[model samples]
Target: MRITRRKRLLIGLVAGFFLVFVTGLRAFDPGFVTSIRLLGFDGYQRLWPRTEADYPVRIVDIDEKSLAKFGQWPWRRDRLGELTTALAGMGAASIAYDVIFAEPDRLSPHRYLPELTREGATGTELPDALAKSLPDTDEVFARAIAGAPVVLGYAVLSGDGGSTPALKAGTAFAGSDPTDALPAFASTLTSLPVLEAAAAGNGAVSLSARDTEGIVRRVPMLFTDGTRVYPSLAMEALRVAQGASGFIVRTSDASGEIGVGPPKVTDIKVGDFPFPTTERGEFWVYFNADRADRYVSAADVLDPQKRAAIAPLIEGRIILVGTSSVGLYDIRATPLGELVPGVSIHAQALEQILSGDFLSRPDWADGAEIIATFLLGLAVIGLVLAFGAIWAAAIGGILAAILYGGAIHFFRNQGLLLDPIYPTAVNLFVVYAAATALLYFLTEREKRFVRAAFGQYLAPEMVKRLEASPDGLKLGGEMRDMTILFMDVRGFTPISEQLTPTDLVAFLNALLSPLSEEIQQREGTIDKYIGDSIMAFWNAPMDVADHARLACRTALDMVRTVDRLNEADAFRFRARGLATQTVRIGVGLNTGEACVGNMGSDRRFNYSVIGDAVNVAARIESSCKAVGADCVVSEDTARAAADFAFLEAGAIPLKGKTTPIKLFALVGDADHAATEAFKTLADAHARLVDAIDANDVARALAGLASCRALAPAALHDFYDRFAERIDAMAVAAPA
Candidate 1:
């Protein structure tokens, strides 16, 4: 189950490919992703909105109330002239008309009298003096515009009539030419020549070209007619109010970095404020839903009595003259989903720029989103592979929450329009789901492989444990503290030689069945069997905290079970006319650092342990026959098993080893270990080993004799080995 370098590379490439795919999609910005982004923008506006209209911009709406009071649609041009003159007299900074005066007013005397003559066919032509005395309605409106701060609005049409409006603001560029980057118009719908000539400035009133979902999200600050660029209605109004001379188009090349592509217009500087825009010079309008505080009815402004009521609202404020009447067809959609007068869009843009609280999507936003998607996706992939699907999902969910929360914070506090939903969906759901599914499939495959490979050798419980955490079945060993156990029947070879092959097989199985159960019950993994002996270890495949103690306990339980089996075998052997010899087993347990994992070739391998410690456990088992003990453990095991009593056995140099390791014979569990008699026997055993090491034969014999009398029957074999050691030392000593 090891993930090779090539496999890891492939995984990274897959994730990288996903990142590249999404990033390219973002670059191209197809309709679906754009729609998602717009949804996020709408959510931000809804969650944290500017409920109050605090900017110094007012809308002179020709609303339903005004239409009711002033008759019907397209009220007399003299009345519109009177409204304009009233706003000018009230100290308004500037009055911009969102309405276009395209044709001559039919109410004017110049046109009405001619219509009267055509209908009657008997009336003589009016006198020249009388005709000259009657005032023209269009001339009255133009005179009103000439005497006040007024910016007339014109439309950029896509049809014929290619007449361009006069550009009042001087145009200049700071860097590369910005004419190519500005929004282009094929034709223009302008006011009458008298109105256009009388106005202080004229600008295009058309919305930007990129309003998705029919929402007026952006408004162009300027537009081009092939030769010259002119400001929009909102921009022209602000320029006239501040008495600014011209528009300063700041291009990307102004920053002194030679850009890869054609330079884009980054900002439009007017007066003291520089408004940030998209490459096409469009401003993102932060809208408030038809605030009542921002509106003053045109009827109220025109009436002398109500004029005083609205004079305070218009003093030194930029006023937009537009209609919200449904019949006028000037209604537009905003971020809040409210239909407001189209003039409100221009008013909001100017207000946002003047208040310095505009929403901006920086040029580097795409790169940031792409990088974030890649890193987040990679992290989720690694988590799912290293842990599991559930854990990876939990972590990914947390990150998603943080990402969205951060986006909201930036939008509310910093006025940034970052798209959090698109990036989050790509990383958390798209990439994470794919990686989790792949990991889950590979993990199940690994579990099935583990079960098939170790099913026959390991106990059922052991196989189940391996299946639960198949990541532990990887090839190559991990160095860990492990307790190794080696068990063998005492006279297995002689006993096997006496039986037929079939009988030997049956006998071995009968003996090994209970032994394997004892080992598995204590959470020991059986490595392999050598003839009648079993080699197993604890703390592999899964961690066992008290591994050394568990191995010791399993060894003792195994010895007791073998003895019971031997009693049954003795009775059967006597009836069969065979020798009445019982079976016995010796076990050796050692605890130390060892490398435990699968070992061998690529085709076949065994989950086993190897190191000097494993060899020492085998050598310990071999020495068990000389000591006449059922089980022996190294000092490492005795220290870890606090509940058991140990009789200290003398150290012996194991075969093929330079250093000798000390050994202890495990006696019983805590209850027996706490007995006064066991304590006395343990102290005596320790003294006997110390005496023998110092070559004091008299003290060694006395100590061994005392232990033999005080110890349980299990200590008899222990004392016999010490007695032989003392005798050998006495014979080898010099006089």
Candidate 2:
């Protein structure tokens, strides 16, 4: 097939569309694409997790053992005050709580005394002045918080709420407004006013999943509640430890970042350390395997005997007060597949910033990926237009391999994130789509030749197969095992005499249409129509499974079709003002090896079979009238199609064969063959053949009688013919 300029241009248009669609998807960056891209970055972390190193971060866990040592949660505020005082005494650098003190302590003396004074019948009231003198537990906890560098946590909400988080640090930005890029919340949930005011820093404890399935992959460095900005728990802890007064943030409009198209937060500085952040002022934390050394049981911290051992771990470390108890519901998932306390995420974020080992996805990554995809995908489409899809796809595979290798190298060595999936997919899809369009055009151009050759002879589906792959079929022949069929109308000469020329054509078309349908429906190829007969065969052009059985089934179906046509008044005998006549058909089947293919010359040919088996089938169809059977098959077909109800017709002299060939009468299908009546008829017919071979006149007559008694009503004529043959044999056997 030669390429045309118009077709080549069409292919180009198709390939270009594919490239655009894929590149546009990357630009749109839907949730699914984000998920796959994030998954690639996650694979890097899983391959080489962050190394476990000593950092100034620790979790003072209120685990199940701590609960057992003290009591269940919501313990009196006085105990929390004691824990705070103890940490301060140990010289802890910073204490960040992953818990909310939203409500006042219920165990305070003033709290219960006022309730008792209202319920006088309970008789547990104290004097108003004495109750006022008693200390408030929340106040005690607040005083302890004031003594140490404590950062209290608050929750972020997306729904309607009235409360707002306390702002502990003032944010100063250089270029664009930092609040424009940071995540904004509708409202916030803050802790108790006294505790929040007394703490050195107040920060958000909440962590957003982004697209990591509830896994903490990104931590917000700053948040906004529409008007005010707030720092995260980790950021506040870092600031308090360093004794920094405020934060410095920079954006795209800054001096060094001015050429960018849009404003995006570029850098943040807490005291002496300068750090980079995502456009939304978020920090990407590289995670390591959870370290057991990073935790100290709160119960152990309060115990006098254990305090000495834990003091060294707590002295310079930023202690996060949180619970690891399953009942606390403070657990969070990570890329490493471990569920750790929520406080650990905040602690890790600080560790990442302090250590200065980071992973960053630059703003230019998407543009780079799109440009690579368009250039590479265009190369493949050009190759498809010039050479074809095969060469183009081969080169595309090489390009994809190179792209993946570079992406993986960047991730491992440079700690940079790049997506290789979108570009590779674009190349593959454009090449495949262009190739399919080319095939369809080529097939359409050559289909006329195929349709003229086998369109009339073979079924529509078979013609389609040839059209798809013209190479598979050629002007040649191959010997294959096939089942041949020959069907003819009974008493055609007599019927022709009754109808006019036009009526004869009409009658034949009406009769042959249904009979031909029966053959084609069973996957048999109709070779041609000879007068009132149909010649067909199976297992040609394509391999038909169980071709022999299918032939037998077609034979039975044609017989039934003719009977139906006769019952439907299709003969048209009465319309001619003559006595009504019935229609009958005879079908012959034989299975054997034969040469089946295009048998004629190159320019003009027909897909037909030619061999001794085909002749045998024609001869067997002629013998149907002599045997008084509607359907007859040779011994070869009977052996292959034993599941059908076939009774032996004994050895008879077929015209061309040297010896007599055995024949069978096909009566019914597999279900009828399984019946006891068919079994009885088969047994009696076998005995009759044996007696005829033995020349036992008495036994032969008796067997013939038994066969007639067991056979169907329509088969009485067949048994009568068998009886006549037996009588002729007895006479020739003269004693």
Candidate 3:
């Protein structure tokens, strides 16, 4: 049993739909992608299209290369002293290190030790000498620290050890806790004198990005260590950068049974002005890790040579000195790269937060993504049903590309966060696969029905169209502003006479399928087949805006499609010992008022057209062989075309016509080469027209010949008809 093309396409479409539905239902992750998009926002803030509406503090990266040049970890105190002094001299606004000088420097343990390690070593001369060298370094570093404004980092332990109640008075609470609150993420300590004496401001650098899947996002703004709430690394930088008097954490009402805290905003008062934030302790980081920006390694500061190039960024900048080396375990996994600099990530976040251009996924985003995907899928499927796989895919791909690219572009340039990947991919995959599959099944079913009913006597496209517009198969008629197209296969009669009936049938089927398909695909109704001639009409059952353009496109495709068929039939033609000349078709199309619908009795109805427009189209097709033209149309048709390019083919009076109709030859101009060639012909034709208007028959003939020569066989057929008209005018000219 042969299956019809319609059924095949329908089956394919259904399968494709199922695939899309499953993937859309199961694979989408709005929260995850949203978080990644936020990170991308940070990148945009720091990188391309920089903004001044961002955090002022700059990152001083200790990159992998710097690590290789300088020795391993923990540089001596004297080196740190030099760095502090350099920053102080440059008049930097403030210098805050993300790293803590938690333990006494190994080089000067006894000198700066918090009395714990110095008790037994005081009597030893070896310890004394080491202490003497190291303690002096500390005093010099301490003086540098003491001279310039500096905010040293320390973490508050949330669960156990943190700033005591005594230290809690001046610090701001991150608002009242919602139910039981969690502890500060990290904690740190230093000797009492070290913490008090050298510090201009004491704050915690302990903060963390919560991860649903161990991917850091949403950095905490304020971390609580039981009684007191402390600032984050970025928060400390802001305070130092702005010289703000203090920080304030604001919270909104809680929701639900758990009473989760509403989004918090951190407000900092700079002088008399307030700087607000999205989260309690956290703001976006603006990353500006330019190669030329301020950067220095702890090892480089230790070395005299490399430190010069790296020292300038530290000058008054809230310099964040942290490890960027892969070996040092300071590298972080960010949306951009796995080996991203940890400090740079913070810097980028800070920059983004301060700009108020955070990568945001509001609660309403998930539904939007799903809706977009669903609609896009539906669109792709509908187009496939209307067109075919190749064209549908092309259109689908273009749409997807535009959407994704536009989203990324908007995010980077306009500071908007939107997900382009999931919607585009999901839509393309689901819609295309589902639609194509259904179409394949429909087409298969159509092929089966056609093979069973027509027994390979009718073309595939005709069968497909029959199935598509079965309503038109009823015995009736309807008036429409239609463009009727007629195609006549050149040399088909002679070729058919030469071949056996079986071979001729095969050849005819091969040539007719694509031609008919082109017409149907362009939304033209296949009126009927008259031996080697095909009659089709556009804007019949369907209203087509550019009916003339569709007619032209259909005609051109029919001519081109024969070549594709000839390639496949080349072997058969060769085996028959024939010349294997390619089968070519001549087409004539006209747009005008026409009567179109099913004709004949109910038992055997035929969908067809009948009107002057239809007659003119048929006459044009008949004239193709005589004029040596492949395709031609009346001026009425050309005027209706908004796009197709054409060459003038002089006026010709039909047998029963009172007024001679002006005609034009259809020329291919879809690509640059064809368009250029056609342009040259058009220019020459214009000159010819000018000569004819002036009754300069000689010049007109000359211009016509030039056009003919320039385009060769391409316009030869059209030129011959013009030449005849020019000759007649020359003979009848007044002497």
lDDT of 1 by residue, 1-735 (tens): 344344455555665677667767777888888888887898778776664657789999998898889888787788889998999999899999998888889888777776676687637777767777888999999999999999999999877775878878998888888788888888899999999999998988999777788888999998988788889999999988888888899888887745558888888888888988888899888876677888898889978998887888999999999988888887898888889889889988888888887788878777777777766777777766555568878888888788888888888888888887877887766777666566556667767888877775566777787777665555688998999999988877778778899888887888888999999888888899899999999988777789988898898899889778767763255557666377788999999999988898998888889998899999999888776688888988888887797777767778988988788787776677999988887787778888888999899889878987887676677678878888998999897
lDDT per residue for candidate 2 within 1-735, as digits (tens), equals 334566677778877887777778878989887887777777778887776789988889999999999999977887898899988888898899989999998878678668777789557667778878988999999999999999999888888764887788988887867676778888778889999899999998877647466777888888887676788888888888888988888887888775366677877888877777888888877899878888899999889888888899999778899988989898988877789888888878878788887778877898998898778888877777776667767887888889989988887787778888778865686545655566567668657767887676666777777676565553478888999999998888888887889989999999998888788778788999999999999888667789999999999989888888877777666556554378888899999999988877767778889999999999999899887899999999999998999988878788888998899999999999999988988898899989988888889999999988888888987888888988898788868
The TM-score that candidate 1 achieves is 0.70
Task: Compute the lDDT of residue 104 as modeled in candidate 3.
Answer: 60
Indicate the TM-score of model 2: 0.60
Badly placed stretches (over 4 Å) of model 2 are 1-9, 113-123, 383-394, 426-735
Q: Which candidate is the best by lDDT?
A: 2
- Highest TM-score: which candidate? 1
Q: Which whole-number lDDT from 0 to 100 does residue 350 have in model 1?
A: 84
Clashing pairs in 2: none
Give the worst 10-residue stretch by lDDT in candidate 2.
466-475
How many residue pairs clash in all the candidates, one count each? 0, 0, 65
| Best-to-worst lDDT order | 2, 1, 3
